[model samples]
Target: MTSTPTRSSDTTSSEYDSDDTNQSVHSDDTSSEDIEEVDEVVDNVAQGDPIWECQMCGALMWYQERKDNSRHSTVPKFQLCCGGGKVKLPLLEQPPQLLQDLLFGNQSPATKNFQTNIRTYNAMFSFTSPGMKMDTKINNGKGPPTLRMQGQTCHRVGSLLPLPGDSPKYAQLYIFDTDNEISNRMNSVRTNKDIDEEIVKKLKLMLDQNNVHAKVFRMAMDMLNDVNFQDVKVKLIADRKTDGRIYNKPTVSEVAALVLGDIDSASHRDIIMQGQSGNLQRIDEFHASYLSFQYPLIFPYGEDGYRPSILLRFVDDTDITKKKKLTIMHWLSFRLQRRKGEALTLLCSRKLLQQFSCDGYTMMEAERLNWLRRNQSKLRVGKYRQIAETPTTNNQSGPTLKGKRVVLPSTFVGSKRYMDQLYFDGMAISNDRPDIVARVFKIKFDELMKDLTKRHILGKVLAYMYTIEFQKRGLPHAHILVFLHPTSKYPTPADIDKIISAEIPDPKIHNELYNLVRSHMIHGVIP
Candidate 1:
């Protein structure tokens, strides 16, 4: 590794390790070239410069410059928390960009996008026109009425608002754009705190009850899968559907008996068989796979016109465990059924019904767990170093914080398709409904993939994985990963740039495009 300077104040900076979890001391293994590099670093520090070392791990080192020691000087003396002064240290290497963003805030030195590379455009226009008049017609109730205004002219009421035809002087003006309007709206914090507290109180009670329900549901399903209770599934389905005096609804105790007892419970089977049109109609065919009972936790159950939850089933037994198949089933279910269309209603086993009898998860905890699992292995900083050896960004990390250079890490990884979906959601708003964003994301993503396929940007899309995430400001963003045909991989910067842009577009020729570029694409200076 070549020597690269680091900030003297960054105490967190340390030697790069292959694995973050492994904290054992490094072995005294050194190549001749590494020893020479260490010697050179020692020679530079021995001249008079000081160095910083980790308080917890004394192995890592960072070089620091000597500051004035006179009482009158403003410069502070360098010291380590472990009660040690700067000392000559062996060579150390820099960390990855991902780590740098984590240790410090995200800093972009090489890329122009990090800085304000484009100027924000401001324009002002008014409908007012000079030397213009509006003619007033008699109010006979025959045609539309016309009125005159001092500063502007009016044509027919239904015609598009036209600008003045004559040449006029112009002046630059600044006004809030659509994006600024949304930002302003987001900035307005709701004054009432009690509403949130009450909501939390209700939510907590709901989650606790749901957890109890989920445990019961899981237990019931397990019991139904038992060999002795082969016909129990049919009884449960019949019990749910039957609603007359001759046939009785299964009580919770009877349901418990069916789950806890053995011997097939002939009475339960009779009740189910007689309730149905046929006596013994393919009982095994009615049994659902254990995986078919999956139910997603939903909140504000009252507003959802259908039952609070559903006993989700797949198209076939083979698709039961496949998450994608389940997702597609749900998508179609809603698109066909919930959208005021016809949907085939299958008999849900009583065991599956019991699982959703109560709500079962805290939205906050569920969201947290889901996010943790989703991004557990996403790209992150391993090591990072500053681009220049000028003044340290932090006062604690002083000058002479030099170290060996390391490779820059990837900017993003995981799923590109999901990220694109998220970008599109942020750009568009529809019907003032929050839940719609999820559907919109899926729709837009499909269209985007289809368009990309037509252009052969990445060749035929083989498969894709995606997730929807909500922003703090209440907008949904999508994260997706696409698998493409081997021949369609983006191999070079030029090939990638054909589909993506890093720089601002020229405003003179591409006025409309420039507005979009400035509003969304630009990444401002890192704080």
Candidate 2:
């Protein structure tokens, strides 16, 4: 979250001291006047107009009214918000050197490009708003307003780049570390069972030597050993306040400056402050410009923006009251209408439609399963019971029931009724198969086998078999075996070379095939 610096009202010490001295000199003529002067000085020191602001929180205070007014110190500390540095936060370790060079190094094209379009870059990466709101209804419209911290206060990152032979960075580094991971897994089950300290010690020693998350492991160990660790609080959001009309809350730019290690740099401040114009860009503009810097994957193309080649299919040009414009929603609506049932209508509740559109079938399936589970005894007593009890004539023994049965009738999943209900099930009608990608792969495999056998692409397939399987990420793939006729078999190396090639297709001659191979056949490192 970026913080903006607030302009404080300047009060010169010379003017204040001179005015007070003159007042005191005249007041020395009378005891009452001297007492009044003393009271005035005390009041000025206690609750007079704020002149200095806290660095962490935006809490304002008079120079003399600071938490620590040491004579040796030029500036005083404010303690109300963050307990005068008692609440310390872990430092955000600097990014990799290569990344830093690309982003902030001198005479670099990446840096130049980034700086030239900093707004666009920031917009591409940032996730949440730094701006906070105050609850005016608190304290019955009295005292300081209660701070209402909303939105994401910190970056919620996904997986980090898997660099070869290096400790995992970011969230993975924290989670997979020996101490953190063991503590997390053990704590969940610790209530039910006691943890063996000896076993834990042995595991930690083993992990310390070979752990992939060693960096965070060392950091965690150090933090555990530190006596002052209890005082440290991770700096996530800026929660500061001021009383009355003295608005001292820091701006987004100031917060950003602090985070970027530019707290004292005038040139960086000038750039962030937009060249001393004192006029800050709107929140929307700030978000658009800086978000990209934080989450690059979300906006991979940077300033190029998302421009899909889709047109609006259902437009009402006749309605002159508003301009007709194409949008992503229009494209979605158009794609949805191609289904063979009733026309897509905008007259229904969009929220309900959205609910059913994405995971309605899954939800319905869950409900059906739950119903079957609840009525298992009732289902087992009827025709399902007969089907389960019916034994094979040559069977060594009748089928044995291992657990409670929850039979799904043919009518529920495979009959004409089941097919008919699909039209009204609110599922997205697309190329994808029902429920899972494995089904789609099965269909494609069937089509390929049909073509191979009928068209003889692989020469009179004598026998063929395939097993569909899913990857760790749930993507479906297949392993196939085909036996060709003896007459069509490639017996020589030359014959095999003629029929099969490993080289990529020439894009100029086989544009479509080249694209297909590039998009689907090719695989690369995950990162």
The lDDT of model 2 is 0.38
lDDT for residue 249 in candidate 1, whole number 0-100: 19
Q: After superposition, how far is residue 19 of candidate 2 from its true place, in Å?
A: 58
lDDT of each: 0.31, 0.38
TM-score per candidate: 0.17, 0.17
Window of ten residues with lowest summed lDDT in model 1 = 118-127
lDDT of 1 by residue, 1-527 (tens): 22222223444333332343122232344444553443354444442222222332232233332122222111223223211221211111122232223223335442222112100000011111122332333434575433332432211111111133411111000011222322322222222221223222333234224322223233434444456643332232212232221122123333223323234555322222111121222211112111111221211111111211223332221224423211222322232211111111111112222222211212222233344446634533222223323344565654575663322222222345457666665565543556676677779877876766555556777777778777655666668787788887788999889777766667888989988877665646322
TM-score result, candidate 1 = 0.17
User: Which digits, one per residue and each the tens of the lDDT, describe model 2 over residues 1-527?
Assistant: 11111123473121233322211112223344433443345444433445345443344444454575443122446544334432222112233333344344559555454334332322222322233332335538656423343432222332221234534323233333434544543443313143433333343343334322233224433553467542221112222222211222223332232122233333211222211122222222112222222332222222111112212122232223232333223222222321223122211213223322332233234445666768867755465556556455665576665555456644477545467677435234322344555566678878887888877987988988888776544566778888899998988988989777698888999989988888767786321
